[model samples]
Every structure is written in C-alpha cells, then in structure tokens.
Target: MHEPDYGVAGRTAIVTGASQGIGKAIAETLAASGANVVICSRAQERVDPVAEAIDDECEGTALAVECNVREREQVDALVDATVAEFGGVDVLVNNAGGEFVAPFEDISPNGWNAIVDLNLNGTVHCTQVAGEVMRENGGGSIVNLSSVNGQHAAPGESHYGAAKAAIIRLTETLAVEWAPHGIRVNCVAPGLIQTPGVAETLGIDSEQMPEREEVDRRIGHGEEIADLVQFLVSPAASFVTGETVTAKGVPKPGNSMSEGLGLE
Candidate 1:
C-alpha cells in the first residue's frame, strides 16, 4: 500500500498576514512540508522575525515581504518578489483580514468600508495578482480565508459577515473561471480559532480552551486550521475546489452570536 503524498515539496507558496495567528501557523506548516514560502504582512518589522524563525526551524526557505493586500500595487510587488526569489508561484493563501464589533445600526460608513476593504477587496487584489502568476506557470492552488459568520447571521459584525460571504461566492466563481487555466480556488471559513488576535479581542486564553477530545469542543486552534489549509493547497486535495470548509467545532444548543464572540 502506498501512502498519500502532499505534493508540496520544492514548490513555492505565498501566505499573507503571516506575522501572527493562523497565518503564521499556515506559513510554518507549509515551509515544514518542504515548500519555499513567502510570508508577508503590512509591517516589515513584524513579519521579518517570523520569516527568520521559519527559516531556522522549517525544512524549506522563507522570504518576508511587507504587503497590505488591500493595495493592488503592494500585492503586485509581493507576487513579483515571490517569483524573483522562488522562481514561480504554486500556491497562494489569502489570509489577511480584519473586523470589529459593531451592530448594523451602529456601524459607520467608514467602519463598514474599512472592514469590507480589508476582508473583501484585499482578497480580490491578492487573488488576481498571484492568480496571474499561477496562470503563467501552468497551474497553482489558491486558498482563501473566510469566517463562519459569512454563512450565518452575525449580530455585531454585519460588515464582516457580508464581506466574508462575498469571498465564498468569489471563490466559487473563480474556481469555474480559472479551471481552464489549471488553477484551483477554494475557501476556508474558520470558527472561533484561538489565535493571538482572538485572545486579545475575546480575552480567551489557550488554557481556557477545551481539549480536542472533549465531547463538546467549542473552540479550535490555529494549527488545526493550518493543517486543513495544507491539505487544501496540496495535491491530496486536487479534486477539492470551489469549496468552503468550515472548521467550527460541533455546535452547542442555543448558543448565541454574542456568546460565541465572548461577549457573554
């Protein structure tokens, strides 16, 4: 019997928002799988140390670039730098996004635009830019990061939910359009993953989280999401595209949105 192959060894990948949290875990996971990874964040100083750490600890190479995915020029530069350093792009993970707690009526126009820009427009910019590289290089895989709020009602995150929902639609459309180019597009909608950002926002610590073996696991870890991303981008999931894998643990009865957001 033969074991399944990840098919990521020696390939080149780009992971955005890699300075911390789930993005950082994805970058580390991919690099450890023998894929030369380009990790980028809006701040050079923040991402540089992560790149160094990955270089020292992982099996593959790591390149750090400062890029805000909302900027088209910056996204272009990021892809160019990746191609120059790693020769070509085989995988692109759009993981840069942000949102704040605000009810629909309380959300200002500026706030709405900001969340949508970062969460939706950012994904668009990165996907289009890196997707071109993939098109030219024969084929590649793209994994988009969304949120479970996209699929369900988000009481205090209306803008975020809207943007994330758009990403899911975008992924499905892009998958069909890019199929002829040998490019695959998919999305991951994570639910309550324990990351630095989540810790700070929700005041939930790792020690407070339930264990994986718990009968009612409510929260998840970044590494768990990273593993899913690795499989999606690797050949093991070659047939998986235009799909949004939601990693939220088994839902509990009568859990409110505010409770999930840690407002309870």
Candidate 2:
C-alpha cells in the first residue's frame, strides 16, 4: 500500500478544541507536517501547553488563542488573530466539541442546549468565520470531526449523536455551497479509540486494553485518526469534499453476544 502524504506545509490552519484529546492530536500532527497552526480552547492556559508542545516539534510556527467557539464573537476574534499572525487561512479544523451522556428523556433544556451549542453551533461559528478568510484566499479545506454515534446511535448519547448527525448534513450542504468559493468541506467520524478520557471514564487500564481490542471491535488509534485528518486537509484529498470518512476499525459480522467473551 502506498503511504499518503498530507501536504500542509506553510499553510495556515486553525484547530478548535485543541487543548486535548483528538483535537490536540490533530493540531500536533498538522504542526509536525509543516503547517503554521493556531489552536484555541476555552482558556489560554490549557492551550498554551499544547502550543508549546507543537512548537517544540513542528517545523512551522504555532499560536495559541483563548477562544470559546460556541460564541460567534469569539470565533470571529479567533479568525482575525489567525489572519494577523499568519496572513491567511488554508485549513480549518472544527474539532472543538464534547457530549453529555444522559438519556434522551433525562436531557434537560439547558443540558441539551449546552451540548448542541458546543458541538453543532460551535462548529458552525468556526466554519463561518474561517470560511470567510478562506474564501477571500480563493480555496481551503474544512474538516469537521463527527462520531459513529451519529450514524449508529448509542444509548445515553442522544444530544451528542444528534449534533454529530447534523454536522454530517452541514458538511454536505456546505460542500455544495462552498465549492463555488473553492472551499472543500468534509467530515471524519471516528469509532471508539483509546484516549485518556475513555480509559478514565471506564476506569480501564493496560490489562483491559487488549480485551477491548478484540477482533470484532471497531476500535482505532489516535494517530491513525490524525493521519486521515492530515490527508483530508492536504492536497491529496482535493476531490474529497462533501464526504464523511469513517475511521473506525472493521466491525465483525457476528452479533454482540457472539463477540462477548469477558466471562471466559
């Protein structure tokens, strides 16, 4: 198999929700690949460390901004700062997102709104602001992070899944509308991957890591996800717009019960 190269060097990219998890990974990978990357989260302190780490490793410059993407004003300022720092934008990764694990019935208005404001609305605000700069620059790439729960709803993830699903639709719509402006918008929905959050949430460690990686599972690696993201933002995927690329591992054909072996 031929390995893909994500040609993002010298290009300016803004990654949101980049203080930790997949967002942080994406920022690091982009920086390593030679992109003039800027990242933001809810606070500058949290993102400063991330920026420092990237600066220590990346071939290009990294900037950290304090931004809460759920608000349009913050997103606007984020774009302006990025433009001032790097001149223009070439890639916009709308990766700042989270979910609340509550049953559909238990999802209060405020709780549901919080999840949507961050996941869906946050993405929208970033895309709008970033797209403006990218449109002015002729063309750019926008990679929206989604989830399998959006495709196959998992219990207690109602708000999260719905927001992600809307993102898919938004990707398609924006792809069509923005193609004329020379912008390519796409989505990447990842399967269960090993992250500190997952491990801590489930209270599992090395001993259970392998068990969770059984043949029938759709687990994946963070680096693998980063690789795909790198591809999407790179010139290699010039024709890959309006698509939702799933990065989950192969799911077995057997039923859940068939794959169940923890008791054994």
Best by TM-score: 1
Cα lDDT tens digits, model 2, 1-264, are: 977656899999899988887888888998998998899999999999999988987897899999999889988999999999999999999988777577799999999999999999999999988998899889999999999888896899999999999999999999999999999999999988766656665577733664764546655777788889999989889889999999877555574644564322
Q: Cα miss at 164, model 2 (Å)?
A: 0.2
Shift in Å, residue 45, candidate 2: 1.2
Q: What C-alpha lDDT, on a 0 to 100 scale, does residue 74 get in candidate 2? A: 89
Q: After superposition on all CA atoms, how large is the RMSD of candidate 1? A: 4.7
What tens digits encode model 1's per-residue C-alpha lDDT throughout 5-108?
77688999999999999999999999998999999999999999999998899899999999998889999999999999989999999999878887799999
TM-score of each: 0.90, 0.89
**Could you tell me which 10 consecutive residues in candidate 1 have the lowest summed lDDT?**
208-217
Candidate 1 stretches greater than 4 Å from native: 203-216, 251-264
